[model samples]
Target chain A: MGVNGAYACVVRTKVASTNGGKPMKDTIFIKPGQMAIEDVDKPTIQAPDDVILHIVRTCVCGSDLWNYRGIDATAPHSQNPGHEAIATVDAVGSAITTLIPGDFVIAPFTHGCGHCAACRAGFEGGCLNHDDNFSMGAQAEYMRYQHAEWSLVKIPGQPSDYSEDMLKSLLALADVMATGYHAARVARVKTGDTVVVVGDGAVGLSGVLSAKMRGAKRIIAMSRHEDRAALAREFGATDVVAERGDAGVAKVMALTNGEGADAVLECVGSEQSVDTAVQCGRPGATVGRVGVPHNAKMDLRPLFFRNTQIAGGPASVTTYDKQVLLDAVLRGEINPGKVFTKSFKLDDIDAAYQAMDKREAIKSYVIVD
Target chain B: MGVNGAYACVVRTKVASTNGGKPMKDTIFIKPGQMAIEDVDKPTIQAPDDVILHIVRTCVCGSDLWNYRGIDATAPHSQNPGHEAIATVDAVGSAITTLIPGDFVIAPFTHGCGHCAACRAGFEGGCLNHDDNFSMGAQAEYMRYQHAEWSLVKIPGQPSDYSEDMLKSLLALADVMATGYHAARVARVKTGDTVVVVGDGAVGLSGVLSAKMRGAKRIIAMSRHEDRAALAREFGATDVVAERGDAGVAKVMALTNGEGADAVLECVGSEQSVDTAVQCGRPGATVGRVGVPHNAKMDLRPLFFRNTQIAGGPASVTTYDKQVLLDAVLRGEINPGKVFTKSFKLDDIDAAYQAMDKREAIKSYVIVD
Candidate 1:
């Protein structure tokens, strides 16, 4: 078996233990620009419908940098750090109906009650009855997952039945890949469309994969990093626009024969990236955005004049997990796991965050056993 | 023949005239809050692909108030005053291959080249090669029209062949009805959807008609004016909200079982109206905005979290005229003309503006024959 997130193994036990009032060895923590692997009280079922998940593989997300890099203020330190996870149920509450302990699962990061208007409309991320505490970070030995009866998807077999790559791919369905797919889906990318993806992050690369899968004839990925650019091409990018801002728009317009792309994906939320994404749409085109808007103040006036639409938001991971991405991943039809370029043992998660912060890895995967 | 705008008759002659530097009774002019009928040089084919239209009927648009009511600045006085036109082609330039003299037509206000990306994509309102001079005010004896070979829709028969009601319906297709339809179309209003229309203007009433025609199970029209509310109901609104701002949103939510509407049409662009429009959308709902934003400064941040898409712009009248509405009007399936509650003779054009300016009429109709 591959250890430390090359592939994390299956969960088999539930332990009764305490942190002993010290930073032990299993969970991750973050305080502005710094991170650590610490011990925390092992989770138990906290709600009637909740379950305790023994996380198999957990990975760092780009949004984690919002707090870790000081873009968003947080407490002096936070015990919770990651969101994506491929896990096995360790405990179940009385209200659980569909899921059972020891069932391998991909937990949708934003726990959703599938009966809500949003979930029924295919945007489970905006579920009306969501409980925030259900998504306690997955970067630990155990975490509470609510909405298990409706949101969590059971994987087909035990961890040993799949390869390391398949494990990481399943982990991706928890957030990143689903988010990228949302961009393409919302933009209504169609066959023979020329699409522009504005960002070089793992999410943007995943967006390139999504557009190609949706039948876009050409995908132009905006990336300057050699490694990310290569991966973007591997994900089906037909061209790369290394420039940004006005220059980047000019490059896209030139590439599209002065008309701009039929659909544009805005995967980075800064004002610059969003503006660039909007600028790259042809008249009657749409810009699908997935980045958490940290500095975005969009004015709808210009979009109104061009007949361009701005759509998409946080990915409905549960929708994608049960309906699309998981099946594709298991069938080896896609390899989104390549996005996890650096891996660490749970004890070395601080290094995982540091590598991603320094751009040393596209994403950091951590194994907790 | 119908004497004035409840149903203006066909154009029989193309007049060659001199104003003698005096205001005359044929063409309308506006300066600040005042309006007058004036005479100007009669139009002639100005470009190779142009046509001179003998205007039969025209009207005051809600947007005309932007300049008359001082929301938008104007040149001391503007000779051009209206965009909607139901006319007959008086002359065609040498390059006009499809149109002939005396052809009854519905001129799409924003002239479009049928082959441009915007036109091909069904958003001819954003046509790339539009000429400013083509759509000179149609509230006159004649106006110069461009892109005649593509954008102008030829009505099926002579003006006299249709009843007064049919004439009014055909005229509605010029702008008002098509615009409201654009809002519904862009919002993707589907069967069984609950639609919210945010405005009391003629366009909003038309939107009520469109939502119903699109099979929406319930249409909530936000209108406080008793007369407009009655009109909204006649156009198929299932509910009426007589509140503004937050109250309007609240009423909509309650009517929708606290989940909000599946699609919202922002037909008025005041900040409060736009805010109400966005607030009325359920998660995954779309807000289609067609009003020219005089005071709208929409922030996309909140919409991002709700998965609400804000789309739409100027109506692609050419697209709708040629593809759907005109045919429906001809078959007597829809009557968008009831929006014209007040009519005036060409010489009473000032009264037309005054009545609409003071909200005495939903829209003012003028006849020029």
Candidate 2:
């Protein structure tokens, strides 16, 4: 198998222990920028369709930075901080089907009951059965995923054939890549259209790749960071606008011959970012935003007069077929893994968060050992 | 030759007058609820593509009430207020084509140059050559229109075939009807959509008509006014929710079996109206608004999680074919003119404003003699 083979073979065992007779595991949390690794009772399978995953790889997301920066006040303090992850099934509930121990899978950012109306309609992110407090936080060493049959995507190749880089690329499909794909999709990025991706974060970089993959002729990345800009180029960004606000809009307008971009991916959720995205879009174009908005309010007058559309909310990652992106990754057509610039052991997540918080790393991956 | 034949023979003649040798005419303005009729230098055709219109029939718009209520600060004191009108083409500029003096035409609320990229692309409201200040204001005895060929839609049938009611109905097409149609079109109102129109104003009632005309199966007008509610029904609203805000949203949700509405038309630009519109929409639905928003801002968090879209700016009335609505009126398929409950001579414009401001009239007409 591969590096994860041994742990993947471990089957679920009924163990009597403290804390509701469940085994305990380590989970990380953050109170603003301060990190803490605490021992928590391992999540027990409560639903027959639940699967317990031994998280193999998890990463810090741009949204996580929102919490780290204390911008997301609603995010409970000491809340488990990760959502993007790859894991191997360690246990399956009695009613679980189509998955077994040793199977590697991609855990989506949000899980949903396969039977809920929203879930059936492909809006798992808005799942009726979802509970933010109880849902799987992939940052944990052991995580319980509900509706496993519909929530997890199986890795196509055998563990032996999966390269480290390919595995990282597949992990991105769980959140960033899927979210980026959603932004481009909702913005209705058409072939030969010029797309502007606002923000130089991993999600914005992924948007550049997604737009390119979706057949856009030109992809512009708005970035101030040299490293992220270079990475954006590597991900198929044809141009980069380092300026922000009005200057950035002026640059984009000049680039597009004053017609503005055909589509704009608003990866940053600030008022200024939203303003720039709307300002840089041509009339009748759309600005698809996936950023976790922080006190963001769009002034309707400009948006109205411009005749541009704003469409994008929390991405329904499950609505998209993860296999398409995975297939592309497996075929070596794209390298989304480049967004992960550094890696840390699960025990060293504090360093990982610090690296990301200080902008020393484009994104930090936590490898479970 | 037609009802307007008397004015047809008055050919274009340059007459030396008081203010800078321009002809003087009476126009109306308002300082909040107080109205005044003042003598001002009549607008002259300043552009080669301009036309001077003798205002024949003009009506108060729901938007005009915004200025009357002192809600629109930008509306200057003594500023001309009317935008909805049907008029006779009195004079054409040197370069004007496709229209002649005495042709009865519908003056769209906003004018476009007809040949700009935005206008050609069917977003005339965002036309590059558009000048709100220079564009015709229909409250006056005489108004100047630019890009006359594109800005004015000729009244198709002979004036002899037009009844006063039919003429008023055609005038509705200039603003209210066109705006309502634009809202429905942008929300992507399907044939069977259950649309909720939030507002009981003429525009909202017109939205009911427009939605029905666009083949909506069920339209719910959120109105507290008995007359406007009846008018809404007459315009094909299937239901009327007298409640406002959260309760109104609940009523709509209850009506939709708790699934929320398929589409919502936010005709009231207040925060409460926008809130109700967003709250009453089902996931993935759209809230199309045409209200002149006063410091309005949409909270992005709820909209994002709901996966609903908010689209609407100033309606691109030119993007739609006015002839279609005109034909509907001509054939007696619809009676939009019924919204005009009162009329006043141009000399008594104050009473027209008072009637509309006090809700004594659904809409008020100003007859220029």
Candidate 3:
């Protein structure tokens, strides 16, 4: 099949007659903004610990925008793109004893084998036994999850008990929400700390919630967009600075009585955003950045004089344990699903990308039937 | 006086005959190898808690070379330099209670007032009551120390008991040794961890010792110079990698079975040095840099992927408490003075700078008596 016209073919090929010949399912891909829905073979258990997931919901992430915007040049053309996901167990391998068919689970962006050194150390994102990222795109109808017992977290209570909003919030635990929590955790945000979160994206908004949950007394969100800024306040931001760059830092410093924030959360991953986050922090403060850094260079001279520490990386979402976030959602503690400003059907993936790309949506959810 | 020819007017001026006539002293200055030794008005007790010291030993630091090589553009022409010193208390203010005449002390590069928030928090380098750096040059015969009680660490026993080598070693604890300790401590170098020290300067050599003292099992020192590399081994480096940049990183990775060191001490503040330190560390590792960063920019992209934390600043030498190091010196446990490869009389300050600037000396000491 030609790479360009491969998506046009929806032909289903039967691999095993004994299993009633499950048909291949369609999946979305994009080269920058160009989208395609291609029929791919249904995932079959290749390992004893593997599980086949029938994806129910998936969401676009700011990191995905990096590839969609062609910023990540190495991202392959027609590459399957989504990672944050909620799915039902369609099939489980012999060794997968913790989960069974019909179980709802949260699939983290990265999955690790249970026994890897990194996984054992609680940094599954850096798992040695795995490639340290999701093998299959979760935007698809079906995904083959390796080391499923360790990689997928079963949602608490029955799958039928969750409302669409609750499920969306729980689904956020897969990536954005967990990533924000990692940011706050790494920054060592404590009670009464005044935190300044750079970026008003889904991750940044989620950081406000995470910091609040961590007992931060004041959460300052840096945002230029009115809609996102309002959402940031709703997510527990005590203040919002509308400026950018030096002026933004100045505003935060003024708000912080000229000492800068006690902790900074850099969620945007842009050079400017990182710069702002660093500048908005006080002496001996830590800036935890979860953004997939794009040409971001932190000037060590200034940071050194201030004794500032920069600590963060890709969030080990699996280590965060989705059950905790799911429990929080069930108790109405945090509504992370508020970030899902737009929604789309499986086939209308183009609209989802457009809304996110054009800044019309904070985050767009894809509902798969 | 005009800034250019100000140093030429070095004629000593006698002041305060009632307190026993003290003549103004000569001090050295350089703007990119251009040297000058000029007489300046002697410092007297400006504050009630100040103490005047007669400097006995002072050292040239690698950081001073940044200004001496014309790399630090902001460095003033004929600026009074030198901060590391061992001195005898010449006079004390009315409010001074820590010491009287004849007491020997170690003067750190930065002094804290001890009452500020940063000082109270053990970050004396970021003291709010002071300018966060040495107020007087230590290379001169006489210097005034503010916040004397908190800034100067008194030498145990008597001034006459310390040998010249012991005094030099104790002088090192004021800056280089303390800075190295800060680097290792911030990097979280635990027992049995593999550590990489990224420079061969006095600070780097001291870092090797500090790491060893901290119980690091394998310390890798990155150095190309035969003499410094040999000293690195003496300072407890288990391995020495002479290559730089990618080759240096490759060597470290090869030594660690492609996993990289658990912690990296960046004792060189150059961009390349910082980059190598970041690359030489494994996932969840940290790079503690205290080399006075000059145009050092940490690329956050690779660091983010590796989950690397970069934490460091000017070593709060006072916070480390020189008493701990002094006792170690007294017990002959660690000889940090081994770093001083060249010595000079007070008049030969230019030669000291030359030896350090040309890398002929790992560190140079000047006898001020």
Better of 1 and 2 by lDDT: 1
If the candidates were sorted by their lDDT against the true structure, best first, what order would they fall in?
1, 3, 2
- lDDT of each prediction vs. the true structure? 0.80, 0.75, 0.77
The order of the candidates by DockQ, greatest first, is 1, 3, 2
Q: Residue A354: error of model 1 in Å? A: 1.3
- Between which residue pairs do clashes occur in model 3? none
Better of 2 and 3 by DockQ: 3
TM-score chain B for all models.
0.92, 0.90, 0.91
DockQ of each: 0.64, 0.44, 0.50
Give per-residue CA lDDT, model 1, range B1-369, as digits (tens).
000111122222223344343222344334667766655566666689989888888887887776567655455545645678899998999999888999999977767788877778888776776634125457777777877788899998788898877878888888899999999999999999999999989999999999998999999999999999999999999999999988888888888878888999999877888889989998889999888765545577788778899888878888888888999898878889999989887778778878888999998887777
* Top candidate, metric lDDT: 1
Give the interface-residue alpha carbon RMSD of model 2. Answer: 2.3
Question: Candidate 2, residues B151-257: lDDT per residue as tens digits?
Answer: 78888754556787887788787778777877887787988888999988878887899899888998999999999999998899999999987888888878987
Q: Kindly indicate the candidate among 1 and 3 with the higher lDDT.
A: 1
Comparing to the true complex, what docking class would candidate 2 get? Answer: acceptable
TM-scores for all candidates: the values are 0.93, 0.87, 0.85
Evaluate model 1: give its lDDT: 0.80
